[model samples]
Target chain A: MDFIRQVLDRVGDKWSLLVIAALEAGPLRYTDLQRHVPGISQRMLTLTVRQLQQDGLVTRTAYAEVPPRVEYALTSLGRSLHHIVTSLITWVADHHGQIREHRAHTATRP
Target chain B: MDFIRQVLDRVGDKWSLLVIAALEAGPLRYTDLQRHVPGISQRMLTLTVRQLQQDGLVTRTAYAEVPPRVEYALTSLGRSLHHIVTSLITWVADHHGQIREHRAHTATRP
Candidate 1:
């Protein structure tokens, strides 16, 4: 259970999930990843991608080119977790309206 | 997209997910909820439950009795979100070992 909680602490974070989801399309440069997951700050994006790489859910590659390009991509494990991330996003999209209605209703209550 | 991010910020929180999962079996009093989701501070649990209630994902029922019993249970919306929570838990359980291995390997890199 502790191990599960530890892992949850890592991946259950919205930033981590968003970063993982952003890498689903293919490899992305750090800037591309930033654009894909809007509102993520530079520090948080760097930290999130680094953590994902350390967790083996993502990989970071650097090419020894003149410009030295770097890209991040999902490992098989990350891809496996993508469905859950997709479902999470889908769930919010599906229910945010009802949730908003409920919040409004609750606010008007005594 | 902004709405989705806002909802994700709420429900994607680890505390919110843990509290939601803890309430899966049935209604639970505040103290019972604390016990079920280990390591949660009183303040965080209170806040999480309140947010869930306001979002219409949870219901708080107060029974007029000697002790004035209050219980929290998942609304259908919360229940609908339960499977995603379960999947998140299962994903961690399934892959924590690999994650740990990767972390260890990364630590040893030059």
Candidate 2:
């Protein structure tokens, strides 16, 4: 349970989830990831990718060229997590309106 | 997308996930919930439950008995979130060993 909690604490965060989702279709350069996942600051993206790499959920590769290129792709574990998070995102999409309604109701209460 | 991010930010936190999981079996009093989710301080539990209730993922019922009884149960939205989170937990259980190995390898690098 503790292990699960730690894992959730790491990957279940907003930036991490967005980063993982951005990488799900394929690998992406840092700039591309930033564009794909809106509202993520450069510092937060860097930190999130570093943590995901450390956790073995993402791999970072740099290409040698006139302009350096770096790309991030999901490891198998990351892909697995991506699938679960995608499901969660779908759930949120389906149910957020209800949550909004509830929030409105709560707001009206004394 | 921003809506999903907000929802995830709220319910995807460590304490929130644990609290929702703790209530999945059924309703539980505050003390029972504390016991069910280890490492959660009373203050954190109180805040987490309050936030969940405000989000309409949890319901708090207070009984006017001799000692006063308060119990928490999941709303349908909360239950849906729980199902998704359970999948995430199972994924962590399946892959945490690999993550540990990755962490160990990363630690040894200069």
Candidate 3:
């Protein structure tokens, strides 16, 4: 249970989800990752990917080349997580209106 | 995209996930909720429930009786979310060992 909670704490954060979703299509360079996940600061992206790598959900590879080429890609575990993240986004798309309506009604209640 | 991110921010937080999971069994009184989701402070539990209620994911019912009785139950929306949450925990259970091993290896790397 504690382990599950710790994992949740790592994966359930907003930035982590966004980062995971951004990497769903394929591997990306660091700058490309930032571009894919809008509004993420450089520092946050660095930290988020580092944590994902540490968790084995992502892999960072640096190719031997001039100017140093590096890429980030989801491991099998991270790809599995992509399915859940997509479902979550789909759920939000389907029900956000209901939630908004409820919030408005709640705001007006006595 | 922004709306999805905002919704993710609300539902993806650590305490929110724990609170939602705690309510999975059935309706719980405020005190019971606190007890069920270990480590949650009274103030946080109150705030978490209020947010869930506003989102229409939870329904709070107050029964007029001695000292008044209030209970919180998952709405259909919340129940649907429960399925996702369960999947997340299951995923964690399945893969945490891989993550831990990766972390240990990463820690030892030069």
Q: Which candidate number has the best TM-score?
A: 2
Model 1: residues with Cα > 4 Å off, grouped in runs:
none
CA error at residue B4 for candidate 2, angstroms:
2.8
List, residue by residue over B1-110, the lDDT tens digit for candidate 1.
Answer: 77778888899887898999899999999999999998889999999999999999999999999979999999999999999998998888888999999999999999
lDDT of 2 by residue, A1-110 (tens): 67767887997797888788889899999999999988889999899999999999999999998699999999988988888888877777788888888878988999
- DockQ score, prediction 3: 0.74
Give the per-residue lDDT of model 1 (tens digit) for A11-110: 9787888898888899999999999998999999999999999999999999999889999999999999999998998899899999999999999999
CA error at residue A18 for candidate 1, angstroms: 1.6
**B38, model 2: CA deviation in Å?**
0.2
- The CA lDDT of each predicted structure is 0.91, 0.87, 0.87
Question: Chain B, TM-score, each prediction?
Answer: 0.95, 0.93, 0.88
lDDT: which candidate is best?
Answer: 1
Interface RMSD of each: 1.5, 1.5, 1.6
DockQ of each: 0.75, 0.75, 0.74
| Model 3 stretches astray by more than 4 angstroms | none
Error of 1 at B27 (Å): 1.3
For candidate 2, the per-residue lDDT at A60 reads: 98
* i-RMS of candidate 2: 1.5
**lDDT tens per residue, model 3, B2-103:** 766777888887778888888899999999988888877899888989999999999999999999999999999999999887777677778888888988
Predicted candidate 3 versus true structure: per-residue lDDT over A6-104, tens digit per residue: 888899888898889888989999999999988888999999999999999999999999989999999998998999887776788888888889899
